[model samples]
Target: MTTEQLTIFAILAITLGLFVWGRWRYDIVALLSLLAVGLFGLIPPQEMFAGLGHPAVITVAAVLVVSRGLLNAGLVDTLARHLTRVGEQPWIQVATLTSIVALSSGFINNVGALALFMPVAIWMSRKGGSSPSLLLMPLAFGSLLGGMLTMIGTPPNIIIATYRQESGGTPFGMFDFLPVGAAVTLAGLLFLSLIGWRLTPKRKEEQDTSKDLFEISAYLTELRVPKECKFAGRTLHDLMAAVKDDADMSVVGLVRSGKRKALPSIFEVLQEEDILLVESDSDSLKTLLDVTSLVLAAGEDQDQDQDEEKKKKKAGEWNLTEAIITHKSILVGKTTSALSVRERYGLNVLAVARQGHRLRERLGKLRLEAGDVLLVQGQEESLQSTLNELGCLPLASRGLRIGKPHKVLLSGGIFTVALALIALELLSATTALVGAALAMVMTGLVAKDEVYDSVDMPVIILLAAMLPVGQALETTGASDLIAQALLEIARSASPAIVLALLMTAVMLLSNLINNAAAAVIAAPIAIKMAQGMEASADPFLMTVAIGASCAFLTPIGHQSNALVMVPGGYRFGDYWRLGLPLSVLVLVVGVPMILWFWPL
Candidate 1:
């Protein structure tokens, strides 16, 4: 009823609307909300930016760096070895795949862990002739489940743990999440591997050779420009204007006499002996040839080149491969032209595939997103390094490799020591992980230039920006008002039912917004709700942590879900089939587990 309460509520409502609308990135929206609160004098002006240096923010950045170090060390590669031989049945395959991803997630960033295993899962599905839809959803959910087991596994745990310290309690130790996190993970994994996978819609079978993930491979053709050709002296822009309306193709690249120009400008003038990389079907190719009098280059081998591209791919040589962009990828919001990807990374985006359909017509201007599979051309080594920097994962069937032996031993040693410090309570998590991340760079487990690149900045910004808003809620008594409302809704209910209601609210909020933001917003209300019930806040806080992590209902809920969308060939509706039941299972399991460990 107060002015401050109404102001904060209005701001939060708009924030939630923007998040669910997804018209803009979450970090940007958070920053805007931060500005709104400050301009309205919600929090102290001096304290408006204090959340930037918050321990939770720092720990998240450090964890991302540490995860990159482990990823670079090839730990996943070591675990991913011989996955195809694990099983043939769907249950066995799902169990093996989800187990590996889940275990990896407990130690590293769940999104990073999912990224590492995605290729392996895809390879297994194709090799065993099973529908990828059956395995990818399970693998994605497993990553979410796995992250619950450790403080650093997901950002929500870190946020809740740090909030505990901020609220006059000691920060949770690293392994404090293990008991509850592990139980939920076990139950969720069992459901996914056994019965959950059956609920997923089968997109296609691996045995169905008649179908393909993308039909663009047959459309790529190389044509040589003859001196007598009419379009020899004209720019590709002109040539495209002539044939583009009739053909769904683009000039992806051009090879000169001995030099290759990847992603040439549309205005670049063409010359004789130029090799034009045309993306078109047989009919389109003929039409183009007829219109321009361009002849097929002698060395141009479409069938052999595409089919055998993977076999001939090497890190040091120019080749073609498919890479999936992660949500953390710098290229997520920008177009290829803006980033100059070809010049910066020595690669070209030949085409893009979204949810199993090809979109190759305007690659140069396409704004990329997480889980988008890109048909890229570049040297394998350059691509390996660049994609690592760009937060992309090359498909496993392409045979790209990860991990460096000497760096592995060094980085592994550093990470182990950090975890030991946290477990022994010798050093705070922020200090230990920050020191370990520096060690990773110093010891060469991660590159010096890549030190900051490994950190997911948008996520850091989201956490930093939202913390103050959460503080504003508690500081202004808005949290208490909300908690009072919740208490009335659950009037006469036991503490257990109240806990379940809190978790359900958090879960629904998380599915609509970033999980970290969900935690930041819910933490204060959870504490207030506990105080209203004259119960301990520990259980309620822990409930926030658990509920925030169960963002299985929508792809927009978590990066792990979105990361698997395109590869799994899933649409918006597909997530709920398995996610809804798994979410119920998490609640049924997690509520009891939290009550046992941190009683109200």
Candidate 2:
């Protein structure tokens, strides 16, 4: 190998090592790799950052924003409503949920489809008394399988299509992937719904109880009805009814003039300065505050100055933080009401958790203890400072935004139009998606501020950063050298065997690196191998497409897998138990389908 090829190979080796290390964020690793290549002069400095504006990067960002718009329009809630009508049997639920995820992923981004359905799968698991692990792994895997069915389903397919077009051949049409992709998807889905789910670890269900499932609900705290609040005139029952379908909170008690009423009557009308004790998760707290127009109570004292300042700040400017009460916390033995958390710290205690146990007492009256988890809300800077002063360690966030269901039709329609544009070849995928995203903002389906938050920056960075590295591989002749070696190995084997081996190699590489990067590197090699053997390039390219999308052996292989890890309580080793068999099934089934559909 030339010096440049050697340098590229060494850089790639370290990059892959960092990816598997899981110490640093993948995007950071990718960015460092991009900079390394630039400094080494492997890639020209002028073109080093060009990947950021590539069509694939733009398309990925646009798709993510569109997915968030669909989510904000309550698309998942609509699906959940129908899902409840499906039979409650575990196997049946798995089949139904996985089927929906897979089908949706075929058209939309696979990670977005998985995110939309993850909660539904968890709910189904809870309702059926099954381990979420059993359902989640299948749902994640199904999303991966579904991505193979269309050009836009996954980034790898888009990369492969672009590669084919650049090689002086007509780009693969949207449905060209359907035949082999469908076959592989069918086989993989069958394995997941039937045999694969059975292989998942049941540690979650066996070790965790229903009480642990309700841990997220422990973040509830009380807010006082201000004199100007609209909810002051409404009865407790009426207020509950108003937010029943959307907000995941309930009125548990009432406090009038510093005295607590543990079980206030449903018909009791809320009064000015009356503290309505509410139970809600962290996510719904902001919505609850907005809907009721109630001010967060610090204590018996109503600070007019603080309330006015809070009212001036935009709703989205506030931050919700989850912190663990440490042993040295001054408020450990005191209740929220007694400690006057809001009065003392200028932070609102939105919810509290002590181990896995539920606090049945009033939120304000419940005594704080060391090791308790508190969901506190305030300005970002103040919240962090308060956590430090109170001796608490912050935890990862958990909550969902409650959005308008009325906008579902509009958002879904816009998304459909974009898909139609791509299908009819009226617009390029990136242009169509960008147009749809802009339309979503224009129609108020997604808010202006939320557009930036909707795009997955890490994913965008990872894709953009890896593109230049992939190009460097091609320019250095490393891809050609690898392809020649593979061709030599396949010379003694049949063409079908060669196709299967090529796919198997790519599949292994995909499991270790980003699937899009794998596709970019492997596409050229597949093309080179086909040319060397004087065989059809179509089958070889199809093999690369299948291999890149079948990254099931490890969670790091695909974002869909990483998305399910924490929620499903999965370990690093948990994936291969189910993923291994499904991967083997893909190779066993995908090769023949590719050959049969596009002969060598």
Residue 205 miss distance in model 1 (angstroms)? 8.4
Across 1-600, the per-residue lDDT of candidate 1 in tens digits comes to: 899999999999999999999989999999999999999999999999999999999999999999988888876677777676787788998999898888889889998888787777777776677777888889999999999999998999999998777767898889899999999999999999889999987877422412345556567678888988888888887887787556556676677766666557777899998888777767778888888788987763544443343343443356566788876678887887689775577676767887677775566567887778887766655667777777777875344344433456677789999999999999999999999999888878888887787888889999999999999999889999999999999999877788899999999999999999999999999989888988878889999999999999899999888878877888899999899999999999999999999987
Task: Looking at model 1, report the run of 10 residues with the lowest lDDT sum.
Answer: 205-214
Residue ranges of candidate 2 with Cα displaced over 4 Å = 204-206, 209-254, 258-404
lDDT of 2 by residue, 62-170 (tens): 8778876886787655765577557667678778888888888887778778766765666566666666777888999999999999887888887777777766787
What is the C-alpha local distance difference test score of candidate 2? 0.75
Among these predicted structures, which one has the highest TM-score? 1
Q: Which stretches of candidate 1 lie over 4 Å from their true place?
A: 205-212, 215-279, 291-318, 326-348, 360-371, 388-391, 399-406
TM-score of each: 0.87, 0.72
